[model samples]
Target chain A: MQDVTITINGDIVTGTIDERTLLLDFIRDVAGKTGTHNGCLEARCGCCSVEVEGDIVKSCNVLALQVAGRSVTTIEGLSKERLRPVEHVTSQSLAGMYAPLEAMGADVNDLHPVQVAFHQCHALQCGFCTPGMVMVMKNYLEENPEPTRDDVRTAIAGNLCRCTGYQHIVDAGMMAAETMRSQPDNSRPAPARPAHDH
Target chain B: MRAFTYLTPSAPTEVVEMLDAHAPDARVIAGGQNLLLGMKDRSDSPAFLVSLGGVSELEGVRAADSGELVIGAATTYATLARMEFTGWHAEIASVCGNLADRPVRTMGTIGGAACAADPRYDIPALVTGVGASLEVLSAQGVRTIEPSDFFLEGGGTSLQPGDLLTAVRFPATEAFTTVVFEKFRQRVFDAALASTVLALRVGDGVIEDLRLTVGATTPRPTVCVTSTAGLIGQPVDAIEPVLVADAAAIEVLGPETSNDPPHLRYQRELIKSVTRRALIRATAIPRS
Candidate 1:
């Protein structure tokens, strides 16, 4: 066993995991953050994506011990702190890049622009791949804030959804881009580190 | 996966010592992108995994004083893609950027990719195509292997059990040369069904020097040295499709030695087309 202390979802957690333990298993089983799902352990499905050191990586392809002393953000960490007081002024407290989603009330309130667009555009069928898709778009839009339909298609190519046929997802991403760019600078939360989850 | 002891050695010497101690039972894991999958599948059951995470020295890309480009073996593809390369190196960056998906690029290292030597991979062809040499270190000492000799006939490299690949060095490309990598895959992120790296040089209006490497469809990346020599002195636009087809057929695909004649024929045809397209695209724009 190797000792690993990692920062996950703004909390520091330490665990002694087997050398063979994958980061995806560590996040789900040891850290008890099951928001990062595992679709294909072989790193193809992109369901096990997470942010480590400001880049999104397939956690299943990474060893748990490799991320020792690093900060990892799973899907659970991608939202603003609901536990904090409503008027909490810490703008940077959110460990993820989904501020636009939170501002539009994607969680526990009104749907985020991406969520609303997905709902309106009918981007999902089973919703198993929704978390991964949202995570990819959140980071992709930050890099290419004004993406065309082709750009949106290329950005979400890694995250596969069998049911939706991808046309609706592309439409939803394009809609979210317009929604994100049109918002005022202050209305949008500060840009978080670009996530590279799958 | 079977449980094993994982050691993170800080220095390259320490890595060699650990490897010497473990020898045949040990595996040096840089990124674990491919190794982890192999371990999970029980294909590679190493008793000891020497993780090189703490070895910071083996992680960067630099232009040496001698005008040679030196890239640390452990440098991740994401980092390499972000580098400002000139001439031939830019071709390398383009290929590295296209390897797998964005996340996989973050974790996968050039050294790991080169060492794995999987025929379907892109890096081996890129390095060998650029005429780069690998720097390897072991308990005994350090030595450089030329690109032509570095990759073995089958998968994997000439690296010994205790050896750690330190870096790869490429001599500076001439000003007249421009390199381009072309790959045809089923998807944007999938491994190449057929790939080629072409480093073409034009003098006046004629082809000066050409280095072509055909990958993915071959058992190893085939550098068409003699075949490329045949193209020299011919005008870039005057180079016919028949020349490329004949070269790929004779040099890259040995028609008589193929076990599966039909598949070999299809691959030869694919190689011919990919090589031609890569050459055209590479020559279309002259490097400044």
Candidate 2:
């Protein structure tokens, strides 16, 4: 066993790992942070991606000891215990636009406009691929306030979503970007914008 | 991957001590991407993996006051790709920049690439194009060897166990030189089926110097310095014909002779194209 010290999300943790232990196994099994899920054990999928020393890298292939003193940021580290609602207007006008699976996943009694657009466009069929898809879309939209369908496609290439055929998902992402950009801050509804809100 | 002992030594003396202690079973890990991949496959396992990352003296990119371009062996390809290069060397830098992906470029270091001597890699031939000489650190201290003289047959280098490649130095040249690199690969960012780099020095409206290098179609890429000598002082009209004639000299040195391998034809075409481009660049720019 080797002693390893690394930051998980925001906490500094130190532990001993077997010589053969991999970082993905340590994070999921030892730390029990399931937010970092596993896909292909090989390097093809980005589901195991985490930021190590500021560079995006696959965790499955990295040995635990390799990051002995490095800072690693996984999906679990993105926010506080409660997400602040940054609601805005134009959340309805673009609801008539392309499909967004995340928006539709929300119940109608508490629907987000992004979800409404997904239902209107029928963006999601089998929701099995939704989590990774939403994360991919969220990551892309955060970087690109405006993206072409091709840009959306390239951003999502490393991710696999056999369900929904991808065309509708691409449409959903573009529509969400347009909606988010056009919205004005005071237009937010007084209620909580569900924690799952994008 | 099997468990292996890891070590990172700060001093060259300590590195030699570790190499002496580990002996033949020791393997140096620069960027674990390739070495660890092999370990994962259970292909070739080492008892120890010594990381050269801690050796600060082996990391640099300096055109020394002597005009020699001295690059530390552990320097990443990305660093070299972004550096200023003139003459025929630009082709080498550009080829390296686009070597693997941007990630691979950032991860893999030149010392590992050259020492691996795998014909599938591009930089080995590029180093030959620049006439760079290598420095290796071992228990015996340091020794220098030119790339051509240092490569072994069957696409491996002359590196021995416990010997760490230290740095590579390219002799200085003034303006009036040019290098053109041409590669033929089936896909973008894929390994080249055939690759060539041509370095030339032009003077008095004629070719004054040349270095011809070809890769990926042989056990180890061969340098055709003989054919290059024929190009010195040759005018533009005779340069192209000389290259075409030199193609006959580039035959695989080992057992895989099948009338005409696609690799061989592609190799010749790469030589022709790179040479043609390098000549055009050299005469136009005038690198001394």
Candidate 3:
């Protein structure tokens, strides 16, 4: 066992964990951030993706101790305000459900453009893969701001989405790229919130 | 994953000592992209994990005084992909960026891939085809192993428990005027089922040096040295890709057997196709 101190979404999470504890478990169990999903225990699924020292890696494939003293940014760190959970966001009402971001007091500016694009493009159906897709797309766009649609498709090739057939996801990626290119200063997510002392 | 003790050594020599002290029970974890997966499945459960991430000497790429490209074992695929390389060396970057996915590449190291020595991985094939050497450090001190000896016949590597692969050294670009790697996989992110690499050097309109390697289909990357040696002095334009590929396929797969499995036959076909493609591309490219 080892004591790992990781800065997660701007929060310093310290835990004495088994040496085999994965970063996915460290984030969801230790850091209490469920925004990062645990789709596959193996590295095949991208659901466990998160940023470590500015590079995205599948958290499930990394031991928590491997990143003992590093800073990690999860989906939760992508915005200033978290969108309040709506009971059921149906496709029929999805068009009318733009108020959740506003109702949660999150302006369009507060959320990462990728998140906004995913919502606008209806990029997700089950939403199990949305967080990973958004994280990867955001990371990819930051590097290649002028990516073509084919480039966006190739960028998210590792991320699997059973629903939406990936067409809308690719559309969202292109939209996000255009949005990011227009606003260079907003390329990276806003500085993470200050750590909450526990 | 079974519980283990995680050890982080900041220097290459320190890692060697740690591995030496804990031989047979300790395993080095570079990117953990491959090791952690095995651990999760209980296929690998070492008592200790020596992480090479913090080891400064085992990271990054540099040009050796001898003009060889020395790539630190811990350098991630993301670093190699984003780098700007010149001439045929750029194919290394291309292979790095194009494999797996962005996130996996960010954490997978070339050394880890070589150390893992998985048959389906592209690194072993490319390294073997280019005749690169592996730098290994053990209790006895550092020594270089040729790719032919470093990689085993079937799967896995020749590295021992106490051995740490420090870097992979590629011959100078002038050694191989052009290099091409081709592979076939069902999905973009899937490991190659069959892969081929062709590294060629031409001088005075004749083939001076030719190295053709077939991987994935074989248990280990097999260099068709005897089969390709015949093409060394052949005129560059007279070399027929189909004839060369057929010879290489036969060399690696051996003579067709009456009861050869359907998959074996399919793999032979794949080897022929990818090899043909690589040879065609290698011959057509304008040599520097």
Candidate 4:
């Protein structure tokens, strides 16, 4: 066993974990941040993707002890407010059941551009893969402010989403790129477009 | 994953000392993208893991006085991709950036891939194709091993239990005029089913030197020196890619047998096609 301390979303999370403990487990179990989903324990699935010192990595593939004193940002860190959980959001009642970012108490300005774009474009269906997709997209858009459709596709190739067919996710990525490009200084969030009525 | 002791050493010498102390049961972790995966599956259960993350000396790229390029063992692929490389060395950057996904590239190091010695991985083949050497440090001393000797015959490395690979040294940039690497995979992020690396120098439109290496098909990346020997001194246009590729495939795979498995046959075909493509692409580049 080893004492590992890591900064998750600006909060210091220290745990006495086994040397074999994965960063994924450290985040979810120790830090209590379940936004970072656990998909395939293998690195093939990017559901465990998180930012370590501003660079994205599959947390599952990394050991907690390897990043003992590093700062990590998970899906929870992307925005100031969390959306209220909706057990089952079907297309029939999606409009009524899903509330807009503002209505859900999430400040539109606090959410990352990628998150805003995902909400606007309905990029997520079941939303199981949203955290990883959003994290990867946010990181990719920062590096490449002007990515083409194919570039967005390639950037998120590691992240898998069985739902939404990836068409809307790609659209959200392109939209987010435009928003990021327009704002040279991303300190302020992109203006929230009118929410999806349907 | 089994419980183990983790050691973080800041210097190469310290890493070797830790490995020396643990010997046989201790393993050095660089990037740990592949090592951790193996550990999770219980395929590898090292009692001690010596991490090279804090070793500043073993990170970044430097040029040796001999003009060879020395890349630190812990330098990640993302760093290589972002670097501005000149001439044929840019091929290395391209290969580094394109293979694997974005997140994996951020953490996967070239030295780690080479040490892992997985045939499906691209680094070993590219290193061998470019005629690079691996520098290793152990309690005994530091030594450089050529790729031919560094990589074992059947999908493993020749590194001993106490050995820690410190860096990969590439031949002088002037050695190869141009290099082209080609591979075939099922998906965008899948490892290469078969990959080929072709490096050559042409003087006045005639082949001066050529090196062809076929990877993934063989247990280790095999350099086709004899098969490509006939191409030397031949005009660039006179070389037939298909014929050269056929000779290389046969040389690497041996004569096709009726009892060969279906995957073996497929690999042979992949080897030929990728090698042929690499040759065509390499010859088409305008020589300075």
Reference-based TM-score of each model: 0.88, 0.73, 0.94, 0.95
DockQ of predictions, in order shown: 0.56, 0.19, 0.74, 0.83
lDDT of 3 by residue, B213-279 (tens): 9999887899897667678787788778898888888999997888989998988889999999998
- Runs of candidate 3 with Cα error greater than 4 angstroms are A84-105, A187-198
Instruction: Give the lowest summed-lDDT range of ten residues in model 4 chain B.
Output: B279-288
Give candidate 2 regions above 4 Å deviation: A31-49, A58-61, A75-198, B84-93, B173-176, B226-229, B241-258, B261-288
Q: Whose DockQ is higher: candidate 1's or candidate 2's?
A: 1
* CA-lDDT, candidates in order: 0.79, 0.64, 0.87, 0.89
Look at candidate 3 and tell me the lDDT of residue A97: 66
lDDT of 2 by residue, B1-288 (tens): 777887878766677678779988888877655666678787868888777767777776777797877888888776677777765445646776766543345456788888778787887877876678998888888999988777876668888887888888877766226676666676444677766666766666677776767777676777765555666778634566445434523533332356867755556666555555555554455533
Per-residue lDDT of model 1, residues B73-108, tens digit only: 999998898888887778778788877887788889
> Which ten contiguous residues of candidate 1 chain A have the minimum total lDDT?
A189-198
Ranking by lDDT: 4, 3, 1, 2
Instruction: Please say which candidate is ahead in DockQ: 2 or 3.
Output: 3
What CAPRI grade goes to candidate 2? Answer: incorrect
Question: In candidate 1, which residue pairs clash?
Answer: A55-A196, A56-A196, A56-A197, A106-A112
Compare the candidates by lDDT and give the number of the best one.
4
TM-score of chain B of 1: 0.92
Tens digit per residue, CA lDDT, model 2, A1-198 = 777777887678777777667677777877777666677654445566665654445566666766667787666554333222325324463355443323333333243334334544556665434434555555556557788997777666655666677778777776666655665221231232223233
Q: Quick one: best TM-score, which candidate?
A: 4
